[model samples]
Target: MANVAAILGDVVEGDRIFSPTSLHLPEFLPAEAVVYPTTEAELAAVMACAHQHRWRVVPTGSGSKLAWGGIGAGVDLIVSTARLNQVIDHAVGDMTLTAQAGAKLADLAPLLAQHNQFLAVDPAYPDRATLGGIVATADTGSLRQRYGGLRDMLIGISFVRYDGQVAKAGGRVVKNVAGYDLMKLLTGSYGTLGVIAQLTFRLYPRQEASKTVVATGTADAVAALAGELRRSPLTPVSFDLLSPALANALGYGEQFAVLARFQSIAAGVDEQVQALSALVGASLTHQILGDDEDENIWAAAGKALFPQPEAAGQTVLAKVGLPSDRAIAWLAQLPSGSLARIHASSGLGTVRWAATTAEDVEKLRFTVADLSRAGVEGTSGYLTLLEAPLSLKQSVDVWGYGGNALSVMKALKAQFDPGNSLSPGRFVGGL
Candidate 1:
């Protein structure tokens, strides 16, 4: 038998010191590693031991989003994905690819390139983020403008539940909505539900033609142009609004930018470009560019959002979802003294905001109440902290109280992971 103590060296010190997988990840510390298994069988065995000993487990990929949720209340063991890296299958005819949980996205990109296909949802740090981590965090990223998100790409999953069950859901094909949409259910469950072992995602054909439109304006002007383009029939693949502060972070300095991407057949791409150029004419500074340009610009834009924890500050990064029109109103509601930005994906209905404050719990509660009073119902407009104080973990509700869905979630969790051994107290409705 392998000694647990001997298995992990320097990962734990005197049973106290620990390491988070993301460099300078925020609001999380001393997250010790327990075991990293290469296959589902090994992962299942680890889960059994954890269930038996009642050890709390937290699964991680590249650790890109370690601070997005509150620190786990009892993280006794961390299941890192460093060992389980592989692209198990890439079925072009099937328009899907099955990958090991630990496979770095960068590694898979080239393989997909050979088949003239790509994962639609591209997070900022694709080269580093593991496939399983992307599914766990639901890291949609900027490409979501055209392809939607992980919630859309992920059609199947394989995971080790807390009860030692190696579970699988969905399949390699697109038509199976068969039983429960457990695949979608687990996308953003924050690992509180299970440790994902493998993933199968829908793929998109590589675009034959692609271009980016960069419109420059002040915060208000950029928001206006973003609004106009959103209403127009010309469909851009991605839309990004960089707040002045965030623009500074991206080094554009004084030039808050609006980015719209369009790609398709060469003729269709040209038509969209002509229509878009007409919209931003004279009213803004515009740049017409190609795919290489799109990659360079977005790489700069998206990378700016994933800075290290210290750079993110002791502030809270919150994701706000509201109707697209009311989306701009948030710039006024947030603390004037704070650093904040907005990126609206596919109109204003699904928007993400990032901000920093000294006291996130109080600030977040106030924002929730403010949006709720304004009738941000159904959603009640909750914000998950991007980075926060550990003390805030006990005080702030990362995902606030839900209504009926919360009950269903609890039951589902109970059915799958009765012990709450995975990501204790770190997910929505305290799952």
Candidate 2:
């Protein structure tokens, strides 16, 4: 601790690091100290010293999503990038931007808005979500239907390895390289492999006009409408199927609903809306929201999906991936009162439920597995517990491990963090 403090000279105590909502309690994972490094060089030096001492270190960026993954064991130091928040560059003409890992999306959004451009991500806790934190979690929102996830937006990354060595991957422009795809490798690694210092992303110009078309019907009917929208010529920025509870929470009537967003020139958006309405006909109750109404609806929708200052019982946030054709069937299997927010275009969704006892959590876990396997298409599905109580997390693997890539992930972790000093036991298969 003395050696690291001497090198970094910005040491802080680790008290008050954990929030009440934190999945992992600070009392369980006692840290020797917390250090903040402003510059990449200082960060590397601190990491190298920790590596030399063989001390476990956990990296943090804004601490927005710190309660995301399994709590890493034996952590001795908490290296924070809070002071590393800076917008390094914004090549507006090139439609690319670069910023330090700790740079908050809230701060960067306005800066990019000046140029009529923005990064295409709408992670929960956006006001505090850092660039590195979003990449580490690979978090996304409704924008995913149009711009894709973090892996798609990321173009370059600069990170410091466990041994204090700096590594680079990709470049400013989108071009293929000869070696490993570090951009994809570390995007959702949960800071187990390396500590991201800076990142570059492809930016998109903000749309001129946006509107949402929402329609309600039975679960099966909504599912069919989702398929129709996917097959139709109309282009939507986001297509989501909301559960009745979630729909009501988002300002819609308490009924199954299909919500789609269209953004473009006024005429283009209007055309798409009319075509969509005609396709659905009078079979379902439908409405078109103008600019102000659209914004309000989407804001309420965001709250429904990721309620601000989440209520005490809303402890679980799980991401499920499966074919859209099976979404309705799969959703029917969930326990009553579970709120689901699903992406209709992509077969991805999030389910939030409250469980009182550990046994109840275990039961829900099995339900997820059974429903995923029950797919009629004979295709596999995935359920990852993005957030949960520490007790619930201890009983089952948060990330169900069935893929063949576990060995490769182990190899990469061993190679990147030979001393097992970086975020030990917080990744897939406890890599």
Candidate 3:
């Protein structure tokens, strides 16, 4: 502790250094102390000190997702980017923006909206999730159907290496193809590689109007509509498949549902809505939501996968990916009380439920294994236990990644963090 204080000098005096007891962090993160670095240089210095002492450090922003991923063996210190919140620049003409990693997505919304532009991502907990945290977790929501993943919107990034050196990749421009693609590599690295410092993203213009069409019916009927919409010429910003539990929560009946959102000029949005309505016809019950109703529905959808603050301790949240055509079948296999929202086109989505005991969660894992075995040929399903109790996490692998690239991932981890000092074992395959 004295050594770290000496290394930081007056920069970390007074309340800047926090005892582990003061914060409500996860049990896996047994941090001795947490430090807030106000600048990139300060962050680098902290990392350097940790490197010299061989201290295991965990990097975080607002600690919104600190409980996610596999539990690391040990943690000596926590490096937080909360104090580094700053928007460096907004290149409106080029439709690009650069901001410190600690900047909250919610705060950036109105700022970007001033110019009729947005970051084109719908990550979880916008008010508390930071730019760096979102990129690190890769929590982009259904918006990926139209705007793509965070890796596509991220044009540039700067991060502090394990050895405390500042490094950068990509650039401020959207067309830069120079050097290695670290942006993609670090986007979902879960802080195992380094601590994200700053980020640059390509922005998109806000549409003039928006409408959401929700159609509810049997799984087969909804799947058929999803297939038809995918083959049609209409463009939807979000195309999602809602499980019976989730649909019921959103005021739809206890049936599988397909929800699509279209955003464009008023006439274009109306035209597409009419086209989709025609396709839906009398075969399935459907509704067109606009204005406040449309916005409220989507907001509620994002919140559905997360437990309320009071229920956070008893809830479990997991992400699942499978063949697009098999999503309905997979949803049908989930536990009775579970709520799920899977992307109809990409087959990636979250499943959440409340469990009073670890045994309940273990049963869910068994169900996942059965579904993986039943998947289509050449395509296996996988699930990641994103948020859960420490007991459940310790019993099961958080990231159920059974892929062939693990050896390569281990090699990269060894190269980037030879000491395994940065968020050790929190990433895939415990890299």
Judging by lDDT against the true structure, name the best candidate. Answer: 3
What C-alpha lDDT values do all the predictions have? 0.69, 0.78, 0.86
Rank the candidate models, highest lDDT first.
Answer: 3, 2, 1
- Model 2 lDDT tens row, 1-431: 44544543542233323322332224435566667677888788878877777888888876656666776676777777877898888888889988899899989999999999989888877778888988988888878999898889899999999988999888787664645689999988988999999999999989888889999877777877888888888889888888787877776766788889999988899999999888774668889998799878776766665654445354687787777766776666666767887787677888887765667655655655566667544445677776777777787777865668898888988888877778888878886
Model 3, 231-257: lDDT tens per residue? 999999999999999999998878999
lDDT of 1: 0.69
Residue range with the least summed lDDT across 10 consecutive positions in model 2: 16-25
lDDT (C-alpha) at residue 111 in model 3? 96
Q: By the lDDT metric, which is better: model 2 or model 3?
A: 3
Q: What TM-score would candidate 1 get against the native?
A: 0.86
Q: Which lDDT value does model 1 have at 366?
A: 59
Q: How well does each candidate superpose onto the true structure, as a TM-score? A: 0.86, 0.91, 0.95
Give candidate 2 misplaced runs (Cα > 4 Å). 1-28, 176-179, 308-310, 357-359, 362-371, 374-378
Question: Which scores greater on TM-score, model 2 or model 3?
Answer: 3
Q: By TM-score, rank the candidates, best first.
A: 3, 2, 1
Give per-residue CA lDDT, model 1, range 98-151, as digits (tens). Answer: 988889888888889998999887664666788888888777876777788788
User: CA shift at 109, candidate 3, in angstroms?
Assistant: 0.6
Candidate 3, residue 95: lDDT:
98
